[model samples]
Target chain A: MRVTVVGLGPGAGRDLTGRAREALEQAELIIGYTAYIELIREEFSHKEMRSTGMRKEVDRCRAAVEEAVAGKDVAMVCSGDSGIYGMAALVYEVAQEYPPIEIEVVPGITAACGGAAVLGAPLTHDFAVVSLSDLLTPWEKIERRLICAAQADFVLCLYNPASHSRPDHLRRACDILLAAGKAPDTVCGFVQNIGREGECAVLTTLAALRDTKVDMFTTVFIGSGQTRVLNGKMVTPRGYLQREN
Target chain B: MRVTVVGLGPGAGRDLTGRAREALEQAELIIGYTAYIELIREEFSHKEMRSTGMRKEVDRCRAAVEEAVAGKDVAMVCSGDSGIYGMAALVYEVAQEYPPIEIEVVPGITAACGGAAVLGAPLTHDFAVVSLSDLLTPWEKIERRLICAAQADFVLCLYNPASHSRPDHLRRACDILLAAGKAPDTVCGFVQNIGREGECAVLTTLAALRDTKVDMFTTVFIGSGQTRVLNGKMVTPRGYLQREN
Candidate 1:
């Protein structure tokens, strides 16, 4: 049995890598979250797909492993790179029980890269990615990371910044950055819907981002202290070129 | 006239995104480093190709912009994501002198994403990427990032780990991690020539990584305290589902 964990990239089929497309073509069973499964179904309509609702990641992963262990080629799909906040880890943990299966995690264009492209070169320097979901990790830990990254002057990519259950997470994260001494005028931006339809990018400042309306599908980028808006594009220069002579 | 900054992905043609391929196909002239120009020559042979040696980034980007402003469709190619340590920023900086040209930055598979796939889900949690090459960036800043990331427990993806001129950079980086209280047995790994020929991945510990031989094309991954070696795979669990019952 062989199970392939495929990252579908942001949301566009054009962003899908050849390896991911090949994995889907080779699979006898496809499993994923409802939205992700739906997104890929148009192109992979002939495949057998099983999708579940949110928060059922454990159950979904177990099912994929069960199908793979039963001598079927399985492809588990996730948005962005499977290794980053995707389903790769849960799939591996579930597959441990049903051993003797070959598993390969195919990388994809994560939200940070996809979003950065839409907003310009906001990630051209050393950066950190933190999830503000606060469901699995303690809020205190997330706050600490935000403050540390801010103080270190690292560009930050914040994932899961806002959802229906937690609308004020972005504001709190911005507060932490502000308290860490980041300038209110520091360049910042957000890409909502990423590569999917209705995609839009906003180039703003850290102070403005505090009250920016965002949701689960939004990917927020907080620039480093040296970030700038040149020709209306936000860019964080690579340290070498930005350093004084 | 349009100038598309294309990211050729790590190395393999299949890793290239559709949008990047489209930009190349639409381009009448392509500009890039000698090695990268050679890599894409077979597919884009008909286009007028201009290649240059290393350490001439400013010169190369200026030529591409000049061609674009002269009413030619141009593509400036770089390995990995064009925005991440690639040519997007350079292209933007140069194109600034000649405004009114459409420039699009097409993202690609960066080393962190491409190499992480081969080494399992080592980047499942918050992470940081620090380039070990001090040619452009001073060693002090690199050392500071390594220490801060270690103290914050951010899984680190180290780029440009070693070159002929600086073979001991990786070792010194590991020493800093060790001094920052990271366990000597903390999971660590590297991928050489990721997504291309001669690609190899290693699963080891921080102590062992100190002596590992690496080169300019290598990408090193340093696992956090929560990272573990399971079934020969390096994995850092996402905090949400990793809480103890």
Candidate 2:
């Protein structure tokens, strides 16, 4: 039996792709982090579900593989696009250790896109994405990349901004951005659990972002010089022509 | 009646969000360019549809506004995210002139995220997105941004890389990138009609990218040094700890 890994795509049930829906429908067992399973829980009623809490990704993925090896058509769910810091890689790694388990990845809308969409496409131009989590990489490298991206005027999307232990990284990143010539007026937006029931977006300037409440569930966007607040919405133009007469 | 502008979210049918699906299901007149209309044609058998050709965006959007003014629930469809170079801006522009029409925007998954998913999250770190389309903005600005992003080593995603009238832009972009110290072996990816039936992804280097045939339908990602090709798949390391055994 084959296993399917599906990205729930942001938070909305409809954001799931047709392929992902079919995979979930056909799966005898659904396994993932609690939040991912909750996001698409309504889509499947008959499937057996296994969910783990935060920081238990490895465990959850391993369990999914175990279920798959037992001849169950299983699906591992991830929020947004599964490959973008999702379960796709972990599953692949685990599969390598457990032979004979066939798998396929069904793509979904990532948080970066979800946040960018709410902010009026600040990423329409060249940009960089950096997660603030230094669990693996040194904070020095993350800082250096932040400086480089800021100086280049890249539209930056940050994930894993703040957890219980890392409350200062986002603040530190803002400080670095300020030192790199990104103006205090640069548009900064944060979207939390985009497309979910409590999903919300905040639009502010870089100087004011420090006062904003951010958490591990938030995705932040730092806009370029061209970013502006238009009628309460943050927008970065994509340079489309109007055929001026 | 209000006009709910829905985004199809990439090319897949399931990428449509719950809000977008509900809006479409409730709409009496569905209006969009041909490609977007074709995406949800099966869901609109009983609804009235007005599909326009390319370059007729303004006209189609105006018609949608007119329909809304006539007290019809209209769904104006856009591919990818509605706000990013989609019909959202045009709808707003026309709505200002036709005050009777009210509008709401529904977001979607953009091509950047779709390409990033296939390329193993080159966007995971800091990145920049720039459009090579000079139809509205001058090429000088686009060139400067490219140079800046390349020098900063920001993973870069380029939209509107080439079209029938501007085939050399992608090649010129590669030249500018080379001048900025990006290595020739730097992993670069090109995806065309991402998530669509004819989707094609090519993983190559910066130097070889200049020789590739790219069209407007393509989104090209030039990865940072952190990006690498793994078993024929392009992957940008997010520095997430694999497992410390």
Candidate 3:
């Protein structure tokens, strides 16, 4: 009767919100990217699953819309929040081509939040979420965002920092941050695999992060000018205690 | 044994992830701001609850840490994601002076994500999250962040957009954005009381939003250059359908 676009959080079962789990549990069919499907394939073993390979976003969404239009209750899952770099917008866009159907978006914890927890609180203040993937956006635009975010001293959460086609993108982003008046020693961190196995988090300077190689599964964080490393954890104070003085 | 910082995800029980609920249910005491405590007090009526009034973040977190250090498992709840403008960082900062007690941050659906879901997929691309309140952070710093975020065309999710002391902040920010070359017709939206009683979502333009006064309870979304309104919903495309050509 309706299509629910669900965000499954970063990874692992515990991160899934109550509503997201309930939607997935009640859905007659679940659809998403092949890798995202693999995340919950075991949890919802009884439900019918449909998936498509990478770069097949449009087709995947169309299939979901078609199924929903045919009276099948569907849940299209995405990693992180379904509304952030996920399938929620595409579903709304695709659903326009079909009969009217209710579309509900179930929000989940995105990488910025999940990774921030593992690396301490680098996003307690104002921040920007940028993706280095140039497959869809131009590198020049990405460069500008890095510069602005750095110049303004906003904590930066970089997504899709590296990929096969853009293996050097993380380095390039780091360079942009460095060039945009950000100090080379700015506290930075990256988390790999998030809640899933092999999940790892490391803290380093902006200079060191440039040399560190990470895969597509990694999420990177660059601290603001006010950020600091205390007790080996990177944290950007919200300026509450300081004002208490 | 540990202090679990949980994000309540807007203001609804359905928005609480399974992990967050479990933490609250298992905790011996739940602590947070007075309003946030009231949000989940009914759901976990069996648990002991403690809260502090506004601007008492330090006292509140210190209390939570004291409770945990005394061997009672405690959960500190925040309205949105505990990491973003939440108490996760403050807890880590306060725990430094005391004995090393386990500090775990359970990520929840932040306002940006929860508000985006109600307003449609306006944050499907990269964005910046900025808070207008300058109670702790100076006003000048907030001004620069607004200018830079607007110049870079990053979709902006604004928190605490207006308050009694800063009633003109949102309008002032819009003036800066307009001065920074953002179009007056730029798509914008705001959601009040997200996921709670009297919840309302409105779609407009930057020009209109500047005049639409909002309280701290509202989360405002300003679209990037690529954002649009389709079928009465605001959406910022990830450039998928366009790239298919």
TM-score per candidate, in order? Answer: 0.97, 0.88, 0.98
Interface DockQ per candidate: 0.66, 0.41, 0.83
Write the residue-wise lDDT of candidate 3 on A1-245 in tens digits.
68899999999488888889999998999999999999999999999999999999999999988898998999999999999999999999888889998898988889999999888888999999998999889989999999999988999999999998889999999988898889999999999999889999999999999999999999999999889897777899999888877
Of 1 and 3, the candidate ranking higher by DockQ:
3
lDDT of 1 at A118: 87
| Model 1 TM-score, 2 decimals | 0.97
TM-score of 3: 0.98
CA lDDT scores, all candidates in order: 0.87, 0.77, 0.92
Candidate 2 per-residue lDDT, tens place, B10-107, comes to 78376666667788889999999888888888866788998999888778878998889889999998888776567775666566567566577776
Question: Model 1, chain A: how large is the TM-score?
Answer: 0.97
Best by TM-score: 3
Candidate 1, residue A231: Cα displacement in angstroms equals 1.1
Measured with DockQ on alpha carbons, how good is candidate 3?
0.83
- Once fitted onto the true fold, the runs of candidate 2 whose alpha carbons sit more than 4 angstroms away are A1-3, A65-72, A93-101, A116-127, A241-245, B12-14, B98-101, B117-126, B241-245
Error of 2 at B30 (Å): 2.2
Report how far off residue A70 is in candidate 1 (Å).
0.4
Candidate of highest DockQ: 3
True contacts kept of 2: 0.36
Superposed by TM-score, candidate 3 places the C-alpha of residue A14 at a distance from the truth, in angstroms, of: 1.3
- Model 3 CA deviation exceeding 4 Å by range: none
Compose the digit string of candidate 1's lDDT tens values, residues B1-245: 88788888888488887788888888999999999998789978888999988978888888889998999999999988888888787677777778678888888888999898898889888998888888777788888888888878899999889989999999999999999899999999999989888999999999999988888989999998889887788888885445533
